[model samples]
Target: EPEVTQTPSHQVTQMGQEVILRCVPISNHLYFYWYRQILGQKVEFLVSFYNNEISEKSEIFDDQFSVERPDGSNFTLKIRSTKLEDSAMYFCASGRDSNTEAFFGQGTRLTVV
Candidate 1:
């Protein structure tokens, strides 16, 4: 069986610094996405990347955010400038197609101070 893997698991950063969250999903998966949960809030979709470009994105994915696959095997999300409100659990997910179920990583807990 294959699953998504995220690195660092936990991260603490200064409010003004930049943070990069990494994830690796099943090799055969074609769709990848980033989502976040702010403590008591619902899991919110940030962006979806497919075919090497962003396929969809939520308002939450503004100018401060960006994502890329630096290598064919890894996907990453970068926050240009962290904010206190950015503290949350960020999850990486992947699926075979738009209609298929997505498998999620445990998540990287980010804390900004």
Candidate 2:
């Protein structure tokens, strides 16, 4: 079945550099969300967006992180200044509606060195 796919499956970056993780979400879904799992911690919601403007974002999605559609099929997350604490598996999710279950991508492992 068609699903979201992320590039570079794993990324290694320095403590203070830029990185952009890419994703291709399900074509028909509307609501999009970004989540991060730090090793064994609970999956934390970073942000949720619909129609471009952010609908909701948690404290984790601070000024250093930004998300964008860029084009029709791609969704990207950019970390302007990476930190060692930012190492985690970042997942992109999509749902048909606001209250529906979201399907998550395999995830892009971000490892800040």
lDDT of each: 0.97, 0.92
Cα RMSD (angstroms) for every candidate in the order listed? 0.5, 0.7
Expressed as tens digits, the lDDT of each residue in 18-101 for candidate 1 is 999999988899999999999998999999999999999999999999999999999999999999999999999999999999
Query: Cα miss at 102, model 1 (Å)?
Result: 0.6
**lDDT (10s digit) by residue, model 2, range 9-68:** 999999999999998889998888899999999999999988977899999999999999
- Count: clashes, candidate 2: 0
Show where candidate 2 strays beyond 4 Å. none
Per-residue lDDT value at 64 in model 1 = 99
TM-scores of all models? 0.98, 0.97
Off by over 4 Å in 1: none
The deviation in Å at residue 54 for candidate 1 is 0.2
